[model samples]
Target: MTSTRLSVIDEIFLRTHRGYGVPIALQGVWRTTGTVSRDELVRIHDRLAVGKLGRRVGKPRIPGARLRWDLSPGSLPLECDTEAVENIVAWADAQADVPLDPQYGPGWRMTAARLAHGGTVVSLVCSHALADARGLIDAAAQSFSGSAVPEPISSPGSDAADALRMILTVLVRSIIATARLWVSARARAELRAFATSDSARTPPHRVRKMRSVVVDIDASQWDSAAEVAGGSANALFVSVVAATMAELGSPAVIVDIPFRTGSGDANSIGMATVNIRGDDSPAVVRAACKAAFAAPVGAPAGYPPEVVQLLPHRLAATLTSTPGRGEVLCSNIGEIPPALSTLGPHRSCGLATRAIHPAAIGPLPCATIRLSTYLSRMDGRYTLSLVSTDDALVESTEELTAAVHRALEKRNLAGTPW
Candidate 1:
């Protein structure tokens, strides 16, 4: 019965859903080392509704009309597939494209498939309206709900001053935003001209479909690579992306790194957005990641930045990129919750491989790389997914994956994890 107020940034996806065809769903894929059965799956679903794990409350009683989670049973569909792992993966991938409709009355979906290959694959598909890439993954963790409850601190008699400052900031930013709009066409033309030599600048072909390539790396080796880079495991993700883009011969690309709200509370999750330049060196990657890690969250309208999303989704996106924003979105959801037998009757050793199968409608930036890990770092391997609008960019995903491996291995930065 708890309803949360969403921020403008959170609504960016809402706008996108309303205007653009972008699939608003953020997807997380897990390969269970053990099989999950229908009965076991039922228990997990119940837990989700009861708020025993993950969601504070389940899906909204209804969708599209508003944002809410309905605790009713049979509300969330758990896709049951007794087929091969690929089948489960494919189904999970398609969940993002499930059109948003008021008739549906909610924006979340779930799938648990018992793999014929001796494991299980589970997916938590949610409307970007519910959470971002990182927030969505955190949503699957049992502890996510408890930590997500937000507490805002305020002082008495300070509202007036804060309100005035907000008014001024909004007025100034709005004016600038308006001016940019009038000249946006020219800006895009300039970008297009600059892109003539760099094919990566081109948006995906009218095929304007979304696609991803998940790259797996040994968990232990990944940790060592991070150590050598003098950064956390997440930094290594930034390094590979920056290195790949540099190899592509682009001058510079701004990587939008949206940091998740540690609590993963839906209301507070949309307030942070980080933009860092990507370049040729792992050192630069290390620096950018550090800055992002330290950057402060922004507020809009005396609240979280979700206000930015109030504008049309495409417009909201353009505001960031029209001038000189980087088109590549690279991020890593460091590690996900390990498999536990409590959630089911399976052996629950841990995950085999993980995939971030993000579903979107079209017109993607040059490219995107999303990384995630499952199980403990000791045995959890990283999953890297390359996303793009065009098939050409999709083709490069493999090359880039190979390139990162080569760079790490060649530097001897990648060694046994002890």
Candidate 2:
């Protein structure tokens, strides 16, 4: 089938159903080293569409979305301008700031312009609520790598439901197992009695503006740093972010980290977004993160991996199966690929990246941060973006951005790559 409608991923669907939408964007500059062909453009479009599901049902669509690649022909030559590429790039960056229309569909847009010089700069803007930022970058890298044309149509799968399903599934099983481990018949019976007697429990808190940060480190350096610090890259990243919040005097914080989905189908990769809320104590945060990282990478190793333990089995399953869960998402789209390098003769290129928050019923933030690695002859660099709405926090957005950069710099992880 050319297209099959499936449910929107948890965060994405929620965003559209409400008024807010995801914005995914990026800009890149590539100096023309070899001949440019229309075939290359087609291939890039096909790759972009590969993973997108239908808006309503979240069903998979072959060649996911049509990409528009417009070029200013050489014949229309104006005066040769060295910074012509920069002008286009600046406009592309401005595009990233525009709000999206949730009713239209997946919030992604791209523009590629040939510069006055032989080089070119490409800009991509997307909604964060639709897909994770890293996912978008990965797809872009694959598209730009070569002229490997994708098969026009591919299988449609229910990939969006994976995150919600997996978490809920794990949660329920954990609860059942924990109950069997810790509760005796009398205790269980007494709990049941208390359940029947207690009434008027507090309402579930509304989703609030998610507070988040973005830091880019050399993907290569991350491992050694983690090993030396006796922590994983994620742990270190979170620790820095948490430390920043502490410095700001925040009593509580919620952070969501993207968990890569194992499925081969592009869409099958679910967002195992993590939340580090409910545990306000620094010791709890540090210990919980440490324990989570200790587990083998592939194994379901994080501590209390199942949250369903907190809910009844039936309810837990229902929540998992259902589309919406009021949760803030934190994700890191790891380093950009080396293939994106701009070598000699390739003078000017544009690399554009953007992030947008998802809209949900409550005030909870559907914000995210993504990083893309960049290379220059003398420097190793990456770009970081943080997406949030004014309703979510009292802190100034500039303050948050500064804190992220400061935190990353303190660890000697990132700075001006130029």
Candidate 3:
């Protein structure tokens, strides 16, 4: 099928949809090193008609409404501008801030910057409700490749008896799980503290500006630093984030880290969100992440989204998701997928990444930090691209960015490239 109903999870995401109401966005930059091709552009445009791109469409106010990727009626212009590198990149970055129209149903937009120096900077503004960061990267690789992407396979068999047995088991266990979840000391403390914080829970009318920063670190050095810190590269990144929160003097913070399971069909993607809580210690953070993602959690692991959708919007927002869940939302898009890195004829050099939390009401995270890697020409160099609303957090963000570089240098491998 070219189209399908917005899944329960998608509907839930749309209810608090980013940019307009809820403020979640995905922005990415693909930098080319060699010649560009119009064929890649055409392939991407074609996928919008027949692939996962259709996942974006849905009717307003209805939960899990039927939606289709209505391929724009006419042909799209394949030609792009030949402009100065600075001008092109600037134009592309500016496009990331533009909001998508929820009603129109095309939840993704593409704007390109053709470098006069003989390359391209491609910018994608996508709705967070549509796909996670990994999903976005996968989509670009899949849909834009010169080769045709593999089609989705058929669903596996299911037994009614087995289904019934599982349902019964869950029914019996939910009582214990529910009780334990609320009665747990951690849960009580989290709610009590979060519910009491006025500045943190101010109503939705008080809109706070959304901001983002994209930072790149040397791939090997990143690994080396993590090894020195006694943790994984991801743990090192999270530790830096924790250090930033500490710099702000936040009292007891929460972080939501989502990782892909790679079990969904090409058209349907889902992920597991691990909320790491407690003090900002590298050991604590690494342990939490490890515990949350130790096993093979195929796509669609958690059932909370379904349950949350069943509740009224206000009640759901208050009880389960957002607001008090975390002070930051982070995703470390580990290594660049080969499908994406070599997706086309353009010899891709590096990739830039960023996420947006467009202006929204209520207290959102201080910032969303995404650490990504590129197919490097140089062994060990880093870069930073930050875009933020004019607010107090920007000041601390500057400090954190500087501190991150300093922390990397402490490992004595910042410029050594060894």
Q: Give me the candidate number with maximum TM-score.
A: 3
Pairs with steric clashes in candidate 3 = 18-23, 18-24, 19-23
For model 2 the TM-score comes to 0.52
The C-alpha stretches of model 2 lying farther than 4 A from their native spots are: 1-93, 96-107, 112-121, 127-134, 148-224, 264-287, 290-329, 342-354, 357-383, 391-397, 409-414
Whichever of 2 and 3 has more lDDT, that candidate is: 3
lDDT of each: 0.46, 0.40, 0.49
- In angstroms, the error of model 1 at 142 is 3.0
lDDT tens digits by residue: candidate 3, 183-280: 58764554455455434531333224433344555666667777876777677666665554444444344555555544342224333334443344
Each prediction's RMSD over C-alphas, in Å, is: 8.1, 10.3, 6.9
lDDT of 1: 0.46
Q: Point to the candidate with the largest lDDT.
A: 3
Cα error of candidate 3 at position 332, Å: 1.6
For model 3, the stretches where C-alpha displacement exceeds 4 angstroms are 1-8, 18-21, 35-39, 59-92, 101-103, 116-118, 148-213, 246-253, 261-281, 291-305, 312-315, 318-324, 358-390, 395-403, 411-418
Instruction: Give a tens-digit lDDT track for model 1, residues 1-418.
Output: 1234334454445544554434445666555666767776765554443331223222222222223332322245666755676544345556555553322434566677766667877766666655555455544554222333222312222334434544566667766654664667764554444445234443423334444444456777777766866676766666566555555453355565545555533533422223433444455566755665564333312232333433445655644222122355555555555532223554443322232323443444332332222222313555555545444443454454565555455434442210
From the highest TM-score down, the ranking of the candidates is 3, 1, 2
Worst 10 residues of 2 by lDDT: 68-77
Per-residue CA lDDT of model 2 for 1-418, tens digit only, reads 1222222242333333443332233333333533344455444554554433212223222232211111111111111223445444333434444444323444454445555555555545444433344545554565566532332443333444544555566667656655654646654554454344213221233334433333334555654555666665556555555544444444335444445454332232343322353323333445665454443222122224235323443453333321212123333445556655532224223243444333333444232222212121212434444444433332554566665566555555663321
